[model samples]
Structures are given as C-alpha cells and as structure tokens.
Target chain A: SQQGEEDPQALSIQEGENATMNCSYKTSINNLQWYRQNSGRGLVHLILIRSNEREKHSGRLRVTLDTSKKSSSLLITASRAADTASYFCATERGGGTSYGKLTFGQGTILTVHP
Target chain B: EPEVTQTPSHQVTQMGQEVILRCVPISNHLYFYWYRQILGQKVEFLVSFYNNEISEKSEIFDDQFSVERPDGSNFTLKIRSTKLEDSAMYFCASSGGFEKLFFGSGTQLSVL
Candidate 1:
C-alpha cells in the first residue's frame, strides 16, 4: 500500500506561469523528496526537505514541508514547456534500516504550454 | 556525474520462465535498491541491498524474487518464475546515504 497521495492529478499552465502541487502522507517521516519524471522514462531528483527544515530550494524549484500536518508542496516558478512531466513526492520513514526505499504518491501530471 | 545504469532497456520473457534484470550502481554508493512501476501506477519499492546482503524488502518481494550482487558493481533482480503481473518498468537506484538516491533509466519488462 502507498502512503503518500498527491493532489491535482493533472495541471495545465502557460509558459512562464507558476505551478503548484500538494502532497499528503499518513505517517511520520524523516524527510520528503520531490521528483520529476519525463515521458515515464526515468525520474530526476529535484529537491529534498528534511523534517527539521520547513523549506528548501534548488534552481527554479521551491519545496515546503509541514511535519505536523504530514503534507508538503512543490512550487515551480517561471515554468516552461520543458517542465511538462509527471511530478511525484516520496516519503522516507524513520527506524527502517532499508534506507531509500521510498513510498511514492500517484504523481501529478503537469503540462506547460507555450 | 555518475549515475546508475541498467541493461537491455526492454526485456520480453515468457510466462513461467526465469528472468534476471541487471543494474550497475554508482561506484562509491553503499546502498542499492529496486523499484517497479506498472503503467500508470505509482512506483513501488521491491527490495534494498547493502553490505552484500538483503537489508529490507517490501511485501512485494516474495520467495519468488531474489537479488544478488554477482560482482562488485552489478546488482541483479531475479524472478524465479515470470508472471504477467511482473510486467513493469524496473528501476535500479543507489545512494551514498539514506537521504538521497539516484535512479537508473529503468528496464521495461514485458512478460508474454
């Protein structure tokens, strides 16, 4: 069973617009990470925010974490057609020695038009 | 600049046959993992390998499944008897630590 669930199953935006996607999980987590998958080929690691940290940024991506609510959001600013893809949020739980075994959400498909 | 690599981007195996999907993780990575995604489904964790032994696995990883690091570099997932249900894209991942993991291009397994 998957623990994480992403909101907005699909989104379409114009170029240069900002896109936001939300994710919610059911259990305590050590950290939350967001990933982007293009054409269902391979996933690219975007950003990771730990439980202690409230926010993180990398290039044009910004991620916010709320441990108390067990939710996180990813904001992509100045979106381009190249940003069209499926975005997923995966949670890392604590107390498990099998690290990096992520429970992923049913990703959000984002499409940016020119 | 290093990343995990998977061979035979696509594999078609017959039912009840044995199939071994191979992966080569990053050189310095200590932890390795396998994940599968059926079309239009969330990526599911199968198993994790570290220190040359199986560390942990999900319920999906059953007796029919096994993982082995045949060499210092290659990690392989073997299905003793292939089933149509096993058809999916299998991804190999590696990480230096528990926080971040880099994934491979993934091998699409098609069971006929």
Candidate 2:
C-alpha cells in the first residue's frame, strides 16, 4: 500500500507568490519530511516536522504536521522560478527498526513562472 | 556540505544481465539506502543497510537483489538478473542516524 499521497498533483505560481502543497499518509509515523527534486537531479532535503511538532520553518519554507489527521503541508513563500521542481513528502514509520527509511509520495510538480 | 555520491549516471544493460550500482555515502553517516523511480512513478524504497547488514527491505527487494557495504566507505546494490521492468533511476541515500537524508544524483538504468 502507498503510504504517502500528495494533493493537487501539480501547482503553478508566479514569482513572489506563495505555493502550498498538501500530503496525506497512512500508518503511524515518527516524523514527516519534505524534499525537492529538480529535473534530472537528486532529492534535496527541505524540512522535517516531527509528529509531536505542529509547525516548523526554514528560510522561506514552512512545514506543518497534524498527526491526528495524518496530514502535512508545505508552504513556499515568495516563490521564484528557481523553485520550480517536484515536491515530495516522505514518512518514517513509527515502529520496528526504521533506520530512517522513508516512503515517498508521488510528488507535486510545482512550476514557478517569472 | 557532505553528500551521497553515486557512479555511472546512466547504465544500459540487456535483460538477464547482472548490474551493480555503486554509492559512496558520507564518511560519518551510519546508514545507507537504495530507492528507485520509474519514469513518471513515485520513488520507491528498496533496502536500507546499517552495521554491514540489511536493517530493512521492501517487497521489491526480491531474491535476485542484494546490497553490500564492501568496505568502510562504499555501499552497493546488485541485481543478479535484470528484468525489463527494472529500468528506472536508482538513488542512493545516507543519514547520520536522523530522518533528514542526503541523496545522490541517481543512476538511470535501462534494461532492454
């Protein structure tokens, strides 16, 4: 079964605008994390919000997690053309030798037009 | 500024052939992982290795697949007999006992 499912499938925005992506997952989780992948590039870690934490931020990225609903959201403020990429949500299952293993979502393709 | 590094940005092999995708994880990290993504598909986990043994693996990690940490620095994933369905971008990632992972650029494998 797929653990993470992202909403909207795709998002588009203009420079200086804000883009938001939502993710829902099944199974109990230890933490939820966000990653970005540029065309033909590797996944880059963005931010991590623990199950206990409600919200966290880094630079222009803000992440919020609601464990009760098993959902998370990533908001990129003041978006730029450089922010065009695929955004994925990943989860670390709560039980049994996780070793930081992550299950990734299909991802939301975000295009920022300048 | 450390990062996971993978070799052979692209690999093309015939079906039933053996293939080895290599990775060099960060020196201080203790865990390594292999994930793959088919064109237009979600990234899927294959296996995770720690302390020279596999800590966890997915159903996709069948008998034909294997992972190794031959030395202190290099981690590798080997497919004994490749299948046409195995064509995908294989990614190598590592973590220093944390949830935030560092991933390599990936090896695009094509099995024909």
- Residues B6-106, candidate 1, lDDT per residue (tens digit)? 98799999999999999999999999999999998999999989899998999999999999998999999999999999999999999998478899999
DockQ, candidate 1, comes to: 0.84
Pairs clashing within candidate 2: none
TM-score of chain A of 1: 0.96
Q: Once superposed on the true structure, which residue ranges of model 2 sit more than 4 Å away at CA?
A: none
Q: Residue A60 of model 1: what lDDT?
A: 91
Give TM-scores for every candidate, taking all chains together and pairing residue i with residue i: 0.98, 0.98
Error of 2 at A8 (Å): 1.3
